[model samples]
Target: MQFFVWAAWLITIANYWFGTKQWDGADFGVIFSTMGISSLFMPTITGIIADKWINAEKLYAILHILYAATMFYLPQVDNPHTFFWVILVAMCFYMPTIALSNSISYTTLKNGNFDVVKNFPPIRVWGTVGFIAAMWITNLTGSKASANQFYIAGVSALFLGIYSFTLPACKPQNLISEKKTFAQKLGLESFKLFADYKMALFFIFSMFLGAALQLTNAYGDVFLDEFKLFPVFAESFVIKYSTIILSISQISETLFILAIPFFLKRFGIKWVIAIAMFAWVLRFGLFAFGDPSANLWMIITSCIVYGMAFDFFNISGSLFVETSTTPKIRSSAQGLFMMMTNGFGAVFGSLISGWMISKYFTTYYTNIGSLSKYVNSEADNAHLLNFLKNKGITVLQNGDLSRALDVKDWHNIWLAFTIYVLVIAIVFVVIFKHKHTRAEVEAINHL
Candidate 1:
């Protein structure tokens, strides 16, 4: 339900903002930071509240209900600024539920006397399935670039929240009762790990790669959809089925996750992570050159590579943390990794990339008059007109353009991402060092 609710709007919303509402690219970029900002504190705060004062299941249900309500209100927002705040409120209610869901699962599983390590992963796999299903439904139903995506998600969230009541209760406990101080409750002691050179460096790179993660999610769907601007590709299957094509990444993610145990054992965590970084290099590089026509294979290959690009870094990095950190600070260390990657890293990626893309990659056409004046010859003008057509631009009855048409240079935007991840991969290979034993690899399974 969680995955379905998010997947319904997350990928395709780019098209809604850019294609439907005609909002600025920089503004669209800021919307993603809402997740990062909420990720920074809401999970911890909600975790504390759930641990000390409330039943985890009930809290999870209530948050989803609130998320659903907020999502329902989102389609009424006519402007990007108001849309940002409304989505921010939705994110605040939604982000923490990810952690809360896990907590509830573990508690329910334990109460059922099931082995969490053995059972939890299979259950989690269904979340990806849910995500893929939502994407397919959104695209097939013609809701990808419309407010109907939000309605689909809102309905799912509402159903999930109501259904959660039927699940086994996971009551609050005395788990953190001994940790009296607010700092202790929040696990601020994990901040001391930043003093260690290796741990600190690992986190710094995590943030860098985290930025890379957001780039694809933010732009990928819209990139394919933007091909519609070119008349040659406007009716192409790639534009029509872009979300389903993107869903291949999630499908690949599940399959690649199964291969991680082998990769970790064979290559060690550091090299596995390095491979993931390089995989990202390939992912972006392929996208940089891919098109909806003959270059379509590049797009498909890139989707396949995303599994290794994402799972190898995220899952392997978690194992590395589990092995390296002392048990006392281990849980907090995991939180710190997530914070650096999904929190600070997300904010860094979203805001900076937004500004950068708006400044460099996006082209604005004020009107037909400006377009003609900017072109060097009739031939070039004809070519530009053939490319842009009459899809997104607006004309005024007074003979002035009502809105500026913004077209993004997708090739260079992807090439820039490729270069960024490639540089990080090279720096990581040179600077970070770790030796893994067979026991260390095996220990991950036991944990």
Candidate 2:
């Protein structure tokens, strides 16, 4: 339920804005940044509320209900500016629920005398299943580029918000009693984890890596959908089923989530995170070269690698925080993790990428047959190309400028992302230090 609510609109939103609404790409980054902006403080604030006053499950349900109400208003927003504020309001209510859900799951499992490390991944895998289901439903229903996607998500969220109340209760630990320090009473001590060098470094890196998490989500579907503009791929299955094809990544997530226990126990959190970083490099590299015809294998392989890239960092990082923090600040610590990855990191990634794509990689092209003699003539062609070049738009070989179809230099865009992730992986391996041990693996069960 948690997964479906967001998935219905999250992945397909680019299509609605770019393809359907024909909005400027320069403004698109801020839309995704809404998630990050809300994540910046909402999670921590809600975490404090859950730890100090409210029941975590009830708080989570309330947030979802509020989020659903906000989502229902999104379809009525006519411009990017208005949509930004609306989505920001929606995300403020939604982002914190992610951490709360994790906390509720951990608390419930521990209360039932279950092994979190062994049991949590299987349960989490079902979230990915729900995500995949939402994507299929959205795509198959032909709502990918319509306001109907928002309606679908709003209804699902409303249902989930109500349903969350019936789940096992996760009552607050009431760690805010008068005997504690004022900081503890206010639930501010979670911020003190940054005083620890190791935890601080871990969070800094998590923020950097978080930037990479949403890049694909922001553009992957539109990237495939844009291929339809090319005559070669106008009727390709990929164009028709871009959402379902992207859902392959979520499907891969399910398989990898189940493998988290073995990987975590064997490779440890540090190594698992390193592996995930490198997987991002590979995922982008594949997308940089992949196409619908003969090179479709690369696209599929990229989707397969997404499983490792996402689960290894996200699920493993959540567990690492769970085992490392004390009961009093457990929920707060989870919220901190979400803040770093989805908050600060996401803000930088989305804003910068949008600006960069608009300034450097956005191109204009039309069908080959649309070219007139002035552009087709060998002598005038160079002059035309030079004009477009001066305006920061490249004219691909054999492309026509008569109709001026706005497109992207997708190859270079993905290539840039590949290089960025690759550099991060190399630096991380050199500096971030941790050693895997049987004892640390055993400690998870005790936690």
Candidate number of the best TM-score: 1
Q: How would you encode candidate 1's per-residue C-alpha lDDT over 1-447 as one tens digit per residue?
A: 889999999999998998888788887779988989999999999998998798988999999999999999999999899999999999999999999999999999999999999999999999999999999999999999999999999999999999988889888886543545678679788999999999999999999999888888999999999887655676799999999999999999999999988887777889999999999999999999999999999999999999999999999888888877889899999999999899989989999899899999998877677655445666565655655444445456654555677878899999999999999999999999889866575785563
Model 1 clash count equals 0
Per-residue C-alpha lDDT of model 2 across residues 218-336, encoded as one tens digit per residue: 99999988776444665789888999999999899878866877877777888888999999999999999999998999999999999999989997788777777788798668777
Tell me each candidate's TM-score. 0.94, 0.84
| Clashing residue pairs, backbone N/CA/C < 3 A, model 1 | none
Q: How far off is residue 42 in model 1, in Å? A: 0.3
lDDT of every model, 2 decimals = 0.89, 0.84
Q: Model 2: clashing residue pairs?
A: none
The most accurate candidate by lDDT is 1
Candidate 2 global TM-score: 0.84
